[model samples]
Target: MREIFEAELQQLGDGLVDMSRLVESAIGRAGTALLEADHQLAQDVIASDHEIDRLERELDERCVHLLAQQAPVATDLRIVITALRISATLERMGDLARHVAEVARGRYPGQAVAPAARDTFVRMHDAAVHVAGRTTELLQTRDVHLAAEVEKDDDALDALHQETFAAMLAPGWTGTPQETIDVTLLGRYYERFGDHAVSVARRITFLVTGDFDSEHAPSHRAEV
Candidate 1:
């Protein structure tokens, strides 16, 4: 029974890695779709979100089964609970990617970001994609150092997010109302994407070191 339980735990970890990979791909493609305004690619990203949601449900069900049957204690219990949280975070990350794709799809045949904001969006995209990729690697390897790198990437994303807002509010800004809205939403999507990625990283850190700081807790909602 102990061996079987251990195997189930391993399976849970594998499930998280799988979810991370899907999220990485989703964000990468979503960024491309946003930058190039590729309708088909955007549609593909939106459609693939269902699979991420499905995986989250399946993982949560398995977690519940383990809790009911195995009655995990101490570290094992923590692992199961953390897995549930990470799965939810990955699902949200996937949703953020889909949101980016949705914006691209909504503005099909025309670029989503205006010319003045395109460069900032491009930087945001690159940082988001990098964070997503690092998140996948962090889950796969459980390297605590990788978690620090993820935090750094999140910082870059935050800076770019601020840059987007500054550009939009500048005196010489000339973007139409629609363009301004699109850019605002797009910046938020990428910024939130980075936040979710950081959440995942911090969770992994807690799992590894058995330490958590409430002050630095993950942000799930947008800051006003």
Candidate 2:
């Protein structure tokens, strides 16, 4: 019975890793679609949303099964609960990626920001890709230390986001008043990308420490 339970948990971990990979690719493709104005790539990412949703539902069901049958305790319970948390974060990442892709589709034949701002967005995209990649590492290794690296990485993205925001606020940024609003949202999308990565890092910390401190409010309930 214990062997079967461990195997089930291992499969749950595998599903989280796979979901992370899918979201990473989706976000990367969305970024490319945004920077390059590639509607087709954006469309592909948009169309892939159903696949992500399907994965999330399947993972949630597996988590429920693990809890129902295994009745995990201590570290085992932590692992199962962490899988649920990670799945939620991954699903949100997919949503953000799809949102970016939608913006890319709307970019048809024109854009809302300066060409220089677009270049900066390209850099932001790179930073987000790095974060997404590390999410997979965190799950695969279950390393709180590696997850710390992602928190540090979020600082870089925050820096980029601030700079982009400042640039957007500059006098000549908006070609039209309407365009200004769009540019602001574009920056927000990038910022929220970092935010999602930070959330994943926090989940990793929870998995290891069984506490959600270093977050806004620490979690008191123990998975065990």
lDDT for each candidate structure: 0.91, 0.79
Positional deviation of residue 53's Cα in model 2 after best superposition, in angstroms: 1.1
Top candidate (TM-score): 1
- Model 2: lDDT of residue 150: 80
Question: Worst 10-residue stretch by lDDT in candidate 2?
Answer: 215-224
Clashing pairs in 1: none
Q: Please, what are the lDDT tens digits per residue for candidate 1 over residues 2-22? A: 999999999999999999999
Model 2 regions more than 4 Å off = 211-224
The alpha-carbon deviation from the true structure for residue 86 of candidate 1, after best TM-score superposition, in angstroms, is: 0.6
Per-residue alpha-carbon lDDT of model 2 for 1-224, expressed as tens digits? 99898789889888988998999999899988887788899999999988888899999999998899878898888788878877987898899889888888886556545574776777878888888999889888988887778876677777787777777777776446545565667667767777777777887787678785654444222111
Give the per-residue Cα lDDT of candidate 2 at 39: 83
